[model samples]
Target: MKKILFTGGGSAGHVTVNIALIPRFAREGWTIDYIGSTNGIEKQLISSMPHVNYHSISTGKLRRYFDLQNVKDPFRVVRGVLQAYRIIKEQKPNIVFSKGGFVSVPVVMGAWLNKVPVIIHESDLTPGLANQIASRFSTRICTTFPETVNAFNNRKSRYVGPVVREAIFHGDAARGLAFTGFSKSAKPTILVMGGSLGAQKINRMVREALPELTKHFRIIHLCGKGQLDPTSTHPDYRQYEYVNEELPDLLALCDFVLSRAGSNAIFEFLALKKPMLLIPLTKQQSRGDQLLNAASFERSGYCKVLQEEKLTPQTLVSQLREVSWDKDEYIQNMSRFQQNDALALLHQLITETAK
Candidate 1:
């Protein structure tokens, strides 16, 4: 059987594309293996897949700011590379595919050391730090944004567009409404997403603006783990800690989205033609990738940008209302977007690159 090794982790954004592609490889009878950080979210996400063999490696968190862990993380990363090299030597995979996270750097390096072809996929407009390091060691780079292809400046780079999960396209609005106990009231439904871990600032602000927001729109909040408020309740509002199978239904029910500017989530919203009010993470909180992602979507007229630095309960309410008023225009711009069959293109590329 053809064999393949995959690696990515840290955040859900890093691992979601791999999750989308894994089942395809499995159905083709390929033996699959995954490498990830010992305690990262990827371990939890991939462990549920019975067909994929999971390997844990000692990976250091890649941070930009000064931290005591920074001094120790390099050694951990080196150890991870060694462990990954051994695993690759034993598995002897035909090709290695990485979705680009801190854990992926070691896996990509190990694959290069083994002379196995390595393909790295980047979802953002610009590459992340891990991907930037792995790019030098990679055989091919796959990008979601057309502009990202130029960012790489490599002949091996290919613009595959966004790889949206098939399940996302099959959501049922009826099922979603039933699941949430929400009626087809005159008010439109707004889905608030703060990513997998939840955004404390967003949760606080949204809750603070609930009295005003609920007057105009019904709310469905995916507040991440342990982010739910036990005392907060409203007839027009619903909250979920996090969702898996039920996510599609919820998406189908929502007419608008208020979310952090993660590339994967925003693109999924775009694909579904949902008007969005994006509040990207501030430069102080992140490397500013979210800001750039939000800016690009704003320029394309698919969403309205709200900088987190300026985020207040009042600002949040006003921006959401603005997005609602301009909803039709946003949908029209999104309708013009012709999505690529990225999963198929990526599958073909991985197959051809395999040894």
Candidate 2:
């Protein structure tokens, strides 16, 4: 039987595309194995999946800032590389697929050292530090954004669009309504997501605007881990620390979205054609990739961008209203960009690269 190794972790975004591809690979009877940090969200996610062998390795965060940890991280990285090399040698997989994270660098390098072909997927317009380092070892680079292809400057790079999970397409709105106990007669429902880690600023502003927002819309907020406000008592509002199996139904019920501009999340929103108000992380919080992701969606008329500096309860309400007004336009723009075959294209690349 054919075998494939997938590696990526840190945030849920880094592993989402890999998660989307796993079922397809398994269905085709390929042996799937995942290498990720022991404590990262990836392990929590991938380890739960049946038929995929989960392997944990040492990993060091690749921070751009001058942290004291930087001094010790190189050693961790070296250890991770050695661990990954050992796993690759033992697995003898036909190919390694990377979804770009700090943990992925070692795996990519180990694959290179072991003479295993590697295919890496970058979801942002620009490559992250991990992907930049892993790029040299990869045989092919797949990108979600068209502009990202040029950023790699590699002959093997391809703009294959985003790998949206098939489960996303099968969301049951009625089931979602039942879960939320939201009535169809009430104001339109708005789903708020602050990414996997949640956004503090977005959470604060949304909470502040709840009095006004709940007047016009029932809110379903995925507030990230440990960010939930227990004091919230609005009958029209429901908050979840995080969601997995219920996310599809939640997306199905949402008439609009208030979210951070993570590429995977936004693309899922786009594929579902949900009108969105995107609040991307500022340069201080991120490397400004979210800003670029948000800007691209805004330019395409698929969503509205709200800068961090300009975020306020009043402004949040106004932007939400604006996006709701333009919902049809956004949906129309999204419809023009058909992504139904994106997952198939990526799977094909993996299979062909394996051969």
Candidate 3:
């Protein structure tokens, strides 16, 4: 039987995308394997998912800054690559599919060194430094946006749609409104999120601004895993560290969303047809992709983008005050957001690639 391995994690986006496609691969009788960072939730995440086995490696971020810690990344990467090399040597998979992140670096390289066909999927309009570096050696590159086409610069690269989980891909908002406590005929509920790992600035601002905003709109906030203190409290607020089951339900119920401009979250929101207010992660952490995504989404009028430091309570409330979900502008903007059927497009790409 043919074997296949996946490598990418740290954010739920990477792992979730991989998980979404497993059922499709399994039906073809392929043996699936995974390699991700031991530091992340990947190991626990895939336990129940269908897979032959999974592996983990200690990995560090490749910071653009010239720091002493970054110097150590080389050693860590070497160790991770060796670990990946051994894993790959054992599996001898026909192909490797990687979502780009720091954890994927050694895994991607190991596959390349072993002469395996590799494909890269970069979901953001702007590619990450790690993806750009790895693209040079990949057999094919996949992108979520047409603009990201040039970022990969691979002749084999194509404009494939995004790979998103079933919940959002096949979700309905009427079903999700239960989590927001809003009747379907009532005002549109807003879903707030900061991805799986969480964002400090987003969490702080939402905590302060929500009580005021919720009076006007029903809200469901996913505060991220382990980010919200148990002591945190507010009336009419439903907070979750993670929503393993109700994720699709909540998103389907929402009218609008305030979230960090992570590629995965953005795709999920768009897939659900919820208008968005995006806060790009601080420049310090994004490796420049969040800023680019926010800009692109804003220019396209798909969503409003706000800088993290500039997110003052009064300013947020003021913006929310004018953001009437009933307005023609909101409808127009959201229409622009449905740029493509990302999931269907991705499925077609994968099917073609597998051929």
Per-residue alpha-carbon lDDT of candidate 1 for residues 1-355, written as tens digits (9 for 90 to 100): 8999999999899998999999999999999999998888899889998799999999997888999999999999999999999999999999999998899999999988999999999999889999989999999999999989987856979999999988899999999999999988989999999988999999999999999999999999999989999887999999999888789999999999999998988999999999999999998988989999999999999999988878999999999999999989999999999999999999999998884
TM-score, model 2 to reference: 0.98
How accurate locally is residue 95 in candidate 2, as Cα lDDT from 0 to 100? 99
Error of 1 at 136 (Å): 1.2
| Model 1 stretches astray by more than 4 angstroms | none
Per-candidate local distance difference test = 0.93, 0.92, 0.75
Residue 127 in model 3: lDDT: 82
Each candidate: how many clashes? 0, 0, 2
In candidate 1 the C-alpha lDDT for residue 91 amounts to 99
Candidate 2: C-alpha lDDT: 0.92
RMSD of each: 1.2, 1.1, 2.5
- Could you tell me which 10 consecutive residues in candidate 3 have the lowest summed lDDT? 319-328
Model 2 over residues 22-111: C-alpha lDDT tens digits?
A: 999999999999999989999988998999999999999999999999999999999999999999999999999999989999999999
- Model 2 misplaced stretches (Cα beyond 4 Å): none
Candidate 1 local lDDT, residue 47: 95
For residue 16, model 1's alpha carbon misses the true position, in angstroms, by 1.0
Instruction: In model 2, state the lDDT of residue 22.
Output: 97
